[model samples]
Target: MKRKVFLSTTFKSLLFLLFSFIYTLLPLQAQQLYQPAEQLGELFEQVQLQSVFPDSKTFPDATPLASPDEILQAYQQQKDQPGFDLRTFVMNNFEMPPQPAADFRSDTSLTVIQHIEQLWPVLTRQPGNDAGSLIPLPNAYVVPGGRFREIYYWDSFFTMLGLQASGETELIQNMVDNFTHLINTTGHIPNGNRTYYLSRSQPPFYALMLRVLAQQKGKEILTNYAPALKKEYDFWMEGANTLNAANPAHRRVVRLPDGSILNRYWDDKPEPRPESYLEDVHLAQESGRNPEELYRHIRAAAESGWDFSSRWFSDANSLGTIHTTDIIPVDLNALLFHTEMTLAQMAEMQGNKAEAKRYEQRAKERQKALLKYAWNEADDFFYDYDFVKGTTTNIPTLAAVFPLYFCMAKRKHASAVAQKIEADFLKPGGVVTTLNRTGQQWDSPNGWAPLQWMTIQALRNYKHTRLADTIARNWTRRNIEVYQATGKLVEKYNVEDLTLEAGGGEYPNQDGFGWTNGVLLKLLTLHPELLQTTEQEAVLQR
Candidate 1:
């Protein structure tokens, strides 16, 4: 009896080993199935639509607790059963996404800068195994906090400013490597390191980040990152050669009537964004425009990193009229100009004269085209070119300062923009994002740290030292005031009215703000006098 039992057990063990070996030999996708969005198709959409979680992003960000195949199989079997609970099924199959910085309480006794230093560790995320929608990075990175639990493309550049001030050189290099890794493995960096964000990217700030790294390490840092930089530039200019008058635009590339090429924000997908699924669906229903066209425009605006702003809207007050892809943004072109010039320098360093010359020519052509098309001679500011209408956009936002930031603005243009800033845009706290009060976070009344830094730096570039100083003083003072009041730095501030918190956006204003911490620390470093102000004085300034 004992021998028969042993033989039966041995036979079962042998079969198990055989099956495991066969499983290993199967195709990778067959063996390990599912990207979160594709795997949980109906479940994903329904969860978002029903508002299973208050934030639409929650379900998409949740991690699978079991093998995707097992989860999917179970879901299919149980979904149509009587008394099926979608929420319970989801909870059983997946781990809910954690609230960002949930239990942390700020120690108000510390100075704001000291508090920022402490918060760095809290905001920093160590890379782990990839699961669900979250794409894994090889190195640890600082997230922008709140719902932004990933390293954002453009946000990282500004965040690095604080990291630099904090003397976190290794951390900065780690971030740059992570971005380069994304370029190497994924072909281009997504808006953030997520499968859902693969369809689009935020503003191209890779070249700017390289410049910062080079400043910290050495000029050779640019040479090392040259290939990744070229890859990014190529990603933006993908269909430039294919574009002609007959097909004026293809993806991000646009060919003007003069046969000059410029870039615009674009998305590969025309569907509602996976994260903001319900919001896009509802907006499209009310938009009256073709759903696909509206979806594309909405996604493109997201790609621009200004999700909903008057700058992208046909009617400043209406979110439904956003037409982002129709306009060639000044800031986007200016950043690309910098990328081209940087590539030229990197090529020259490596003795690739032909590539160097090619990049130089591209940069010059872009500069000329930018001045011709995007520059508003009457307003003396750079505006986005509405290619669909064959005219410059009437909306004048902080993007006008980008030309000056890149040293592409003429002396007259720079002076005019500085005057415009002081006369119209500058506020008690900082410069407002744009002149229009459209109840969009990127519009009037709300000031963001990155824009404040850009405007101040742009003015300083033009030797408008007094204006720069005044702006810096106001901005730093406001930051200090907010910190004293709330014991937390926020994503955006109410620059126009100091008493109220920054408002207007899909979500409430978020704290643990990566860019705010970064820009504030850098500003304080530059203007140490702002640190010495008494609490009463900080309050009185408001």
Candidate 2:
């Protein structure tokens, strides 16, 4: 027994020493990783502004063929010379990111399920050595495809749902471990693995991912990720203790009028996003608002995963009027509520009574805050609270379903929400994202896969099985019809107009979609009747 204890202690000591030595060896600049935009500085701006690659994100994702210093020195020496070719220089110095598998021909006879299964291997990225701007994971992960060449924070959770259905347990665990590594190294998982995304994180789906893994593996999986769960919760609630009446908002944490705390989406940095640099700069220039404040709001909207939605805009018609930081989002708070509840359960299982109680109390307070700030009694649905304006923003959307998704809504409220969905949100194809046809993709005429899954499950939670089944059938049918036409699954669908492709975003609607595939597969598994033989036969000519 003594020998075993001694060996364990020696092993831990060695690990500590090795880590410390490696930490010391990395210089401050090397330790603080930079994206290509920051590394190449003026050169990056020129490349983007001149439309060298057309897509602003392209240059940022490109891997440098040599060190940034060498490239910059060459630029300095050659940029001043007459007839200096910028495009040729960039092509020579950087290896452009690979485009999505646009050329991969699909087997026409295979059904959507078979296509998804085959695409799994294609979507699955193996672990690689770190490349320029790409933060390499220790374990393999599934990317959401088409310009999104990195593992996104929230997208992986939904992607795992499909993985679970496919019986790819190892891949799911590998992705979970990758997120754990991210939390340990970066304090929180960023929007994705890119260095430019370091300032912001997407919805706090880490706890939800852990819940899925635990459901499959057992409660023991929770204990294994207890530290990560706590770290994620801490990152969102970082400034809760500092918030006071005088300064009610701090970063992501917002202290309400009733003294209850909730969260809002926020990004640490105020600069224009490197991925959307040109668009952000143009918007900021056009808005005539404080450029920093506008940039932060845009970044916060990005953090919401419903980027450019009317839900974040003060004026529902205009993206320029976005005031995301001032709004306490119902979906964000519900996600945090689930995170707290998960942490409490994990703590209780670990036999830590005090920590468990602390989390429980936090969850209760947040639930109360959600009811107080977000629930609209007259409307009988939840809406985001504009804390700065001290009123409900009153933009109705699929985000209202989040409270039910977490089982946090009152039974009466759930019934009212369901009625609202049937009356306004539900559509022929599925449920439209919002009632307004504002050109933003998260608005009317569009139905995203993640929102569909959430709404269907939320309806099921409230025992609205018929509505849930209706949604499931419609959504899955729409997915099949589109697949039959295009031979591909995509990021979002035009649920209001089945004949048209989903549109409205900085980029075109992406194919090889992660969440769409995951949600559709899971829905089909739940309601296999949705996959009619007639639907499969329609794609035979492809």
Per-residue lDDT of model 1, residues 1-542, tens digit only = 01111223235334533443444354433424336667777777788888888888888888888877788788889989999998898888888777767998988878888999988899998987556777777678999999988889999999999998888876787788788777765678899987889889999999999888778777875777787788888899998888778999999999999999999999998998888999999999888789899999999999998877899999877899999999999999999999999999999999999999999999999999999998888988889999999999979899999999999989999999899999999899989998998888888899999899889999999999999988888888898777887788989999999889989978889999899999999988777776776455855766
lDDT string for model 2 (145-223, tens) is: 8889899988988999998888777677778877877776777889999998989999999998987877766667677
- For model 1, the local distance difference test gives 0.86
TM-score for each of the candidates: 0.92, 0.94
| lDDT (Cα atoms) of all candidates against the true structure | 0.86, 0.86
- Which candidate leads in TM-score? 2
Clash number for model 2? 0
